[model samples]
Target: MSSRRARFGVFGVVALLAWGAISVVRPIPERRAGEVISGVRTPAWQERVDSLQRGETVGGVLSRGGLTAQEATEAIGAAATLDPRRLPAGMRITLGGPEGAPPSRISFQLAIDRFLHLTRSDSGWVEHEEVLPWATDTLVVRGEIARTLYDAFDEGATELPPGARSELAWNVADIYEYRLDMSRDLQPGDTFRVLFERRRGPEGTVRIGRVLATNFASGTASIDAIRFESEDGRGRYYDTVGKSLRSAFLRAPLEFRRISSVFGMRRHPILGVWRAHRGTDYAATSGTPVRSVGDGVVVRAGRMSGYGNVVDVRHANGFVSRYGHLRAFAKGVRSGTRVAIGQTVGLVGMTGLATAPHLHFEVLVGGTQRDPRKALASTGGDPLPSADRPAFDRLRADYLALLQRVSTQIADSN
Candidate 1:
């Protein structure tokens, strides 16, 4: 989480910007109308860059780039692998050909990792796809909690790409969901450090990739997580001793948010009578996504008396979790639908027996309601297999060593 500004080393910024493989592309100039000049036709290699407008079709983009109707249709047909309507607005397309003639080459980036090339052949047009390589670098960011993790990330990750800090915070919280509740566990003086991947694509777009290693410290308690993949082919985070960070259930059903009500005897907001509150209420805005706290099949998804719209998921451990006051169920979520941990199931709402927009979450064991916090805390994660311990140990050692090197550099810089 974030309070103190993390040290983003000057070298890291310079190294990221100095990727030798990344180069700026310039447009080719237009040539004069061809007239026999010195009996040798001067080949006019004209290039134009056009962006796809909103609600515009591929044919429209081709026509605007000087392609005839017939040529545009042929080009579209040649690139049948790409869905023309699926192309997002602001996608840049490059057209190149002789001046005053239809383009011979059409190019566009389909995604950060994919590029499409359409070229005119002797018989017809042909399409070729290219994979764009990204320049990747590992960087370190350290922050101290002030008010919340979001604040810490906003203040500390100034060197990160716009909008990336928020994503990083969410991802960090997700990695430790079973071990820590970001909304309540972190204090003002708590600290966090991360070693993460920064990738830059051909368009100079920067994004946060994988988190290689991270550590969080609150008072005398500290937790360190390192990324590792075992022979089982599943990649996950583990502690220094190789214990997994993932548990059967998440600490909470929603992302970091304020708790409006806790489980206990309380006066009913609607009935105005003292009663047992069998669930925890999380105060959140309507339309905010609510996720399943664990892997389970939905046993029920319909309106319940006083609960409004609700979903009941039955986990493998015979524990049933209930989410109530949902605005709408996510697509494909219904009775008998299997859901994975952290999968979105509904949206927060105030439909029945509620005063404001909030989620009423409950955990039931043996057909009886239990405190979600205490129930989830009783679960635990698995440890690395003895056969895979050597590989995990090697990865953890290397990652920690790299993290320490960066910490030393930060200390030296200050």
Candidate 2:
């Protein structure tokens, strides 16, 4: 999240950034170019569902659902690997047969997308790990920004999982991080059309797949990004013509954190003076991962007056970025070490003159401090590799047509 000189504390900003490794681990499976898929699957074996009650054991659920006591015991034993003791109340359990019968299988969530599937084997009940079978579909949603992008999509968000909602915002912000300051640039009347892959299960659980393409428009600013991958399996967002949507630098080194302060004249938080604030402050919990916004070499990774622990990365085009008030530098990251864009360089902290944990981020162009927002955006990078162009161009045309249809639908509705 980016905003003009914010009054929110530093810790508020950095903790706001990342949703954790869970975001990547659960990402919707990537689709190759020209793949067209849109629909939900209805599995015939999804025959029953029951809720786990407080103080109810797996054996109890099994018995109540029609398994004989001995069968329940054997099934529970087989599911021991999942530690049934930790089963949360209200957990939904799906079965492969109707009530009053020994189901062919019992499935319970292990985590997002993962499940513990208990089945009857030749010898006895056995447990097997399973992941939900997803039916990927194209989801077209258009919303006028009321406050944040999340709020725009809040109408039907209750049906989606917690991670889905958080990831939707994260993905949207990530796609436009370089082009727009999410914390500040999103306007109330700005409208967005998101064309993405939506994965649904037989029981109706749903998650955001991959963001295939996005078109966002505000008063005067607009951005369009299409997801594309190369033969080597490296996927990134690119524009219609295949220009990389990624700039050489990231808008912020951290995830969803609000901008607590910006680069400009301001009242110093500690010094208590009307002075020039040379850096931006992102509030976050201590130890939130701080990243290098661009590929560069660490120029400094230590302390300075009022700056606390710091890591400065020097990039090409006479640009240098500083991350102060770090809890610690990332291992093996020090002066002269090469770093890549979005690589962890340090952790947020309050090691220097600060009241709370936060990352003090600054960007210097030609050795002069500039607004991190503008400085990061100026580094627009290159296009897709020449070899990937033909594939990307074909994909781009398809996506643009889909976006056009969505826009037309919106116009007709209005």
Candidate 3:
């Protein structure tokens, strides 16, 4: 009986020893700080992915997405093969592990023409060269005009960069090259809207494409989308239905500039005598470049008595435009050359019988001088075709809407 009892005790001791050894030898999962405990097994840590948007600096991207600077740097170092200092904006980075675990893996996507995959491995990140989906997005920009076109854009929440605004205004002038001039008739409350293309690069950089639709309003006068075409057929912008918005001639030749004198009788400032001022005087700086009001053949290009350097352009219609008091003529702008509207013809100057530097401009109808400011006869051209008319209507509606919206915005701000 004693031997049997002793055997049982030995078995019990051996079982306890075995159990303790097993517990010590078995691998245990590490518990990390900031980790949530649920029952016995630890859950796989997951983190929300962050956007790699263009224009955001490397530091900005991480900070904006709830990452500390140290963590972002460490993660970038661990996950990406590229230098973290050179990381561009618009890069997508995924972080996994516990809330604060170093990034396990970093993936890069080349968003250029197409998506090419790049993944990090033991050897470091390398190009995977996988194909990705190509996608395009569209946005609508609308606004009204009050005080100024820039103001209208601001009111519409479509404010553009200075360079962009300058480019846009230039585009508008080009479209209306023969019909309207931005330097002259863009009134205080002119409103407009532009629909155009925007391209995203591989690094999430944004690139602006051509203008698709535009509507401009000045006083009661307005111009809807008159033409739309892209040199590259990647995109299109027209009215409700597709049609061209381009016109042959812009309505005005000048934009946002004041007329210092008219083409009529006026007192001569330099001569100190009353005389007939046969040309309109555009008030501009001495070096301000003068542009041709319409497309025409240069009939005269040289110096004239009391006119200083001059350029005369003959249009298809029986109309002629004369630029006088020019400091110098544009290069290659000689007689017999074809010049387009808005093409630099000469530079403003105090030449000829003038006291101050200005552009002495004149328009002649049928070889007779007429008031260039008052003349409204369309020099001979067909209106947009029936197919394009619907597009124009839509453009006009958009402009009107933008103008109204801008007006409302201005009123609200006031």
Candidate 4:
């Protein structure tokens, strides 16, 4: 038995030695760094993100990101659509290529919804601007006016993106400019409801789109405006009955601002005498654009006594509108020049006999100065035609229903 066991052990040792010799003669192949294992290939490129520093040029940024000076120049040349030197600080940029090698592709955000991409080709680098899509959502916002429309919007649309509330207030004021002077007509208890489009981009940025409908109530007066496109394919605000919201004359010469002085008896800031003040004074910053209230011909565009740098426009039906305290007259705004409504005629200034920067607006009937608010209130834009009444009615109903539903939801939530 002992002799048989010894023979089996010897055979086992011989077999192990033969197996080790065979392994050394024929070794298995080694895999490369980016070789395909099974079915998936290892990625050849890596991505690096960076932000543009203050006062840094595009070439400097590219060079700092492991790119040669020649490659940076080529990339800058490819970006013809944008000025590389004007890129804002903190703008995000992305580079993609093999690790430790020059980037073959680069991309950067131009705006919240715009991107610029550059890629290497056989000849040189090519570039293209990309416009990102935005998804739109209709929402209703309601607020009460404690001071001004801008304040009310800020208080009500708290979740709105920055600057959106101000934009909405301006748009709403524009819609009601014909019927209501937003600068002064709004009372403390006045309330407004707006139904507008809110657009959201892929990066979660928000912006205000079209205002579909709005309602503003002050005292016993309630005004409603609905957006409808006419046969000319232009969008205009109209009442429930389809009467356009635009008037022959805008309510104010400057955009929505405070009224420093009104018509009638008031002590002049410069003269200190209680006398007849024929026009309304709108307090605004210097250089604010002053617009023509109506379409008219420039009868006067020069300096006058106490009214520094004035522009007088003669409209239809013996009406003449005057803009005073202008820093400079707009180009081509001379005598006999025809100007359109809402056109920029001059910039606000304290050039003449004015104590501070303000726009003095006056409306003349025949040759007598009259109250501008009462004189221009009766004028209105064209009403919707009978053929388009059905479309207007349908749109009005839908938007009003949306406003009501949202208001109810808000009340319940509160």
Candidate 5:
């Protein structure tokens, strides 16, 4: 019996040794499909990234990247969830495939920090949004407004950079647009200070982001705006006490090339007769989009004599606004249609009594037309909600410190 048990134990040890040798000798099987999808066993694919040229189409770009027409079509269709039609020129595009093989993965920027990723799958192709790496750097630009903001940057070494200078002006103007008329308010002696964070690409090719905090002193009137981003990533500018800086209405109905005429009496351009011009005239391209200045209900839409195509919106506190000289109304917009602030109502055109393409804007109180400039003198946006005070206070303290440091540097330099 002892001899028999010894023989059985030796046999078990030999079997275990044989099993270990076999495991070492045989190769493993190919990775499972789930492993590939989860990125555990990806192919040794090569990648190339490029920027889209002007007038480049997705299919055309893909075809140039070695994709067949059919492959391009399938990829585009699969990535259609990203609404690729809105992709602007200079967007980054990346293609991935095995070395010496056609690309099976395509990624393109739909926005600065957002990417649309498309990969070939057994069922066809799949697409999703992948956030690209984005970074922020705090930057400061401080100086007095001399002539114009752009000109202020045109000087010697002290001058602001072209794009950066204009960006600072636009952002600062946006903050003060409600309280100051940019056309008539800014002067040579006025000083300006801005501390903004520049959101940049991974390569740091670009500079400038949203305004973090700003201060501009024009005469005795001064304004302060601090940016606060909520937990969900929504950002807005507010005063120290937490009131929103955005006016209830946008200072301008639309971005205009120039203000052709101001409100009040003027020599009628067409008739050459002095008459009361109740609205401000903004000269812009014929196809420029015209936006409503505030949230309101469209009270009147369609034509009127001389005024031609027009839209009238009524807002809270007995305020009424008008947009005129539009080429045509936006689809589905009519009397009683609800519109939000900055909603496009129509396109700019020379539809009325004007000789050139322009928009005529007006504001009314209690049925009497008032200067649009006066109506925009006050920022009518609500204060920061009480619920947001705690979060806002913390952000405000941080920004104020940043602003103070930059301001001290500017003063010392001068």
Candidate 6:
């Protein structure tokens, strides 16, 4: 019995030695650097890394990391405590195993500071908060009006979004309150441009800020720029090179005109109503320009039943003016368009039950309409600075001389 036991033991030793030799020669599989080995004997570390990168949100990251939904949630919770709800739309994550072996487990961390770590859960990317950065850039846009200002903006060439055109018109009126009245005299080929600031949001939303500059050109006359200036520490509109744009009185008080049965009310030419005449009736020549008597805003511009193509402007210091019986409107002339003393607003035509072409012009103090022709209280004069008057006079003289030369040349050609 002892000899048989010895033989069995010897056989066992031989078998163990043979196994050791085989192990020494063949060796067990080992992981390379940056590689992970799993108990399932699969090379899943690379797949997991790829999955995490493809995830748009935290939850997606965990699922791609080879974790079940619940497992990924819990793992992500433990790793970053991020809230899935607050996760950003386009975030990426990376994962890696310990060196020299397949990764048995992995973890995640956020690099962007805006991401707020939330509670962890069994589900992937359970909770998180994302904060956005503030914007500090400025944007500018310029446009021209040909034929009509509204049509130019509304045609979508300006590339502004909805409601931008109205806002732009308002800005022009606000800045050039003393220069342009868009109702009466805007010719078919008149042109204009504006400058302003734009703000953008993190979500790619955009909005316009304050208007910085504006230019309006008509015929041979042009107002180059309307800008903000500080003189004596007081800010006001100045020209392109810093000159006052204000004047004592506006060039014209009414926007556009045509002769509508003369100044007297005789049998109410069109209405047949017997009423006392209070103002002159200028005939509207369809597409004629309308000018503002003074700098003001269009408090009203539209139809008033019998008055057709009516426009009313409210000026500074309790002054108001009205224009009626027109054919069509100038570009950008609306309820809030600002006008200078001589700015053209609309064209002339016989509208609103008019018997013939003519503008019904009226000036109002407080709220009562009065005779515009008689109400001419000579206002608006040069704003030449007392200290700079001499210089301005000299410049003006030189400019006049040059203008005369050009005029003579043109006359010679004619």
TM-score of 2: 0.67
lDDT of 5 by residue, 174-260 (tens): 666555656545689877667766555665445556777887787897777888876678887787777777777777887422343
C-alpha TM-score for every candidate: 0.75, 0.67, 0.50, 0.80, 0.65, 0.37
Q: Residue 166 lDDT in model 5?
A: 60
Q: How close is candidate 5 to the true structure, as a TM-score?
A: 0.65
Candidate 5 lowest-lDDT run of ten: 405-414
Model 6 per-residue lDDT tens digits across residues 1-414: 999999999999998988979956776578799885654644433424432333366666656554567765565556445555565444545444434443335433343334434333344334445665534332333345564455655652254565666566655555554455454345666666555455444655555555545557777866644334335655455564446766544424443122222345667866677987665566545566767776789998899887799888888866678778878777899998988767777766788867777777777877877755445543333454667555445544443333323121111111
| Count of residue pairs whose backbone atoms collide, per candidate | 2, 17, 39, 0, 1, 64
- The runs of at least 3 residues in candidate 5 whose Cα sits more than 4 Å from the true structure, single-residue gaps closed, are 1-135, 149-161, 173-188, 200-204, 256-266, 274-276, 385-391, 406-414
lDDT of 4: 0.84
Error of 2 at 396 (Å): 2.4
Best by TM-score: 4
Compose the digit string of candidate 2's lDDT tens values, residues 1-414: 355335455656655654465466575588999986687654444456787999988778877777788887778888767777888998878767633446878888766678888887788877889775657666666678887666776642444577676677678788877777676567788888777766776677777778878888888767789998777787799876677877777777787643343333567778887877776777778888988888998989888988989888999767999999898999999899999988999988998888788888899988899988677774455967898888888998888778767332222111
lDDT of all the models against the reference?
Answer: 0.84, 0.76, 0.60, 0.84, 0.76, 0.57
Which is the better candidate, 4 or 5, if ranked by TM-score? 4
Q: Which tens-of-lDDT digit does each residue in 250-286 have in candidate 3?
A: 4443443333332346777767889777756767778
Q: What is the lDDT of residue 203 in candidate 6?
A: 59
Prediction 6 global C-alpha lDDT: 0.57
Between candidates 1 and 3, the one scoring higher on TM-score is 1
Residue 345 Cα positional deviation in candidate 2, in Å, after optimal superposition = 1.5
| Winner of 3 and 4 under lDDT | 4
Task: Evaluate residue 159 in candidate 3 and report its C-alpha lDDT on the 0 to 100 scale.
Answer: 38
